[model samples]
Target: MKQTPNVIVIEDNDDDFEALKFAFEEDGAPGLDIERCTTGPEAEHALDRLRDRAEISREDRVLIILDLRLPGLSGFDLLKTMRHDSRLRRIPVVILSSSSNQSDAIESYTAGANAYIRKPRNFDEYVDMVGSFRTFWTGCAELPVLG
Candidate 1:
């Protein structure tokens, strides 16, 4: 059986998280195992635990959606740390932030982000964005096996 894709969303805003959840549901991809981390440190600890898992299947896939403006450590700091870590480096990290600065996007890619997406302004846009994200990341992209 194909395992459900695991998605770790590191976002500090509750409203954005709720909107994302609603969008995923609207996209009809309820099979995704989505987890939320309110701060960068929380996500870092969670990723560390996931990386330390004893056994992982070849089909296991994990994705991280990070926000640039976070409470502790900052998203850029976390991205830099993840790139340096052998195990975490394999997991794909996407930046989903409200920032529209060109410098932020450039920095995100330079720091090791797989993709950088700006947050949608409306609920309909959110749904469309989530749908596209689901179709690409889960259906089309070949995710790295995680342990």
Candidate 2:
């Protein structure tokens, strides 16, 4: 059976989170289990919670959509932590940020981010981006099982 993937969105801005959520819903993503974390610390806590879940196995799917700039810990720090932890390193991290800087993208990629995507300026663009995201992550990509 195909396991449903859990999407962990690490975005601090309320409006941006809502916009992304709306885009996901509009994109016809079924069985979309989303977890929103306002800060990097909150996201770390959430991921740790999932890690401790007895029902969660290594075969379970998980995808982390992270923002570069956060209130508490920066995205780079979080990514580094995840990469070092054996239990979390397998999970693919996708960087979604408003920053369009080459350094940010290069740094994200260098830090083991699977993908770096810039946040869209408008709702239409966001919808399209989300659509592509859904298609790639859910439809095309083979995700690692969360244990």
Candidate 3:
């Protein structure tokens, strides 16, 4: 049986995380194993654990939703680290941030982020954005198999 994709959300703010979770739930994206990491270091450790899992199979998929401004280790640095690790490089990373800076977007892509998305201003917009996101990432896009 194929395992549902795991979504690792790396965010520091509790409100933002709750909003995202609510949005996904409202979007009716069931079967997704959503996990959260409050800090960049925590995310890094979790990713390393995933990578080192001996039982991991090719059917396992992991998608990272990263925030740019983290408590420690920054998103850019984490992206760079992940890109350099062969075990982690294939996993897709999407940047979800509040910054509208073009430089941040550019830097994210340059550092190996698969996509960059700004946070929506309203709850309705967030729901709509998550709906589209779920449709594309979970339904339309073909993600790489980890491990």
Candidate 4:
């Protein structure tokens, strides 16, 4: 079996997604694979594919970095549905949105977001945060990986 912790970025911003992908690659975080899905439905379908391939398991550390404002199924809706799903409820979900509203932050945590991060306005700050994320998730955290 071959597995590593996986991160799924669920945001519609193509530019943001590409930037993040590049940043992660630049950070040289090995043993981690990054995946992207532009929409909630697309993410769901991708998750299904992963499951079919036996890539995601009950012990997999599948982190979801989501944007609150989406075109169709909003991040809130996706969070709610994921929480209700038995198979995916345990996966860590982090809200990474540009919204600065307190209510959005409150609702995200209340609705079971593991972490709520405001999208950084500065480019350097954004990269720094992603780098910090890599450090924490890959270094400090004892994430699940396949044998």
The TM-score values for the models, in the order shown, are 0.94, 0.93, 0.94, 0.85
- Choose 2 or 4, whichever is better by lDDT: 2
Pick out the ten consecutive residues of candidate 1 with the lowest summed lDDT.
51-60
lDDT of 4 by residue, 1-147 (tens): 333478889989987887777777777767777788888788778667655544444555677789987876789988888787666676778899888999999999999998899987766777898899877766767654321
CA lDDT, every model vs. true structure: 0.88, 0.88, 0.88, 0.78
Candidate 2 clashing pairs, residues 3+ apart or interchain: 57-147
Residues 1-147 of candidate 2: C-alpha lDDT, one tens digit per residue: 445589999999998999999999998788999989999789889878866752456566889999988999999999998888788888899999999899999999999999999999999999999998888888888887765
Candidates 3 and 4 compared: the better one by TM-score is 3
After superposing candidate 4, which stretches have Cα over 4 Å from the reference? 1-4, 50-59, 144-147
- Tens digits of per-residue lDDT for model 3 on 49-99? 878751467677888999999998799999999999888988889999999
Q: What is the Cα-based TM-score of model 4? A: 0.85
Lowest-sum lDDT 10-residue window in model 3 = 50-59
Q: Is candidate 1 or candidate 3 better by TM-score?
A: 3
Candidate 1, residue 8: the lDDT equals 91
Candidate 2 TM-score versus the reference:
0.93
Task: State the lDDT at 61 in candidate 4.
Answer: 63
lDDT of 2: 0.88
Residue-wise lDDT of candidate 1 within 55-131, one digit each (tens)? 55556688999999999879999999989988788888999999999999999999999999999998999999999
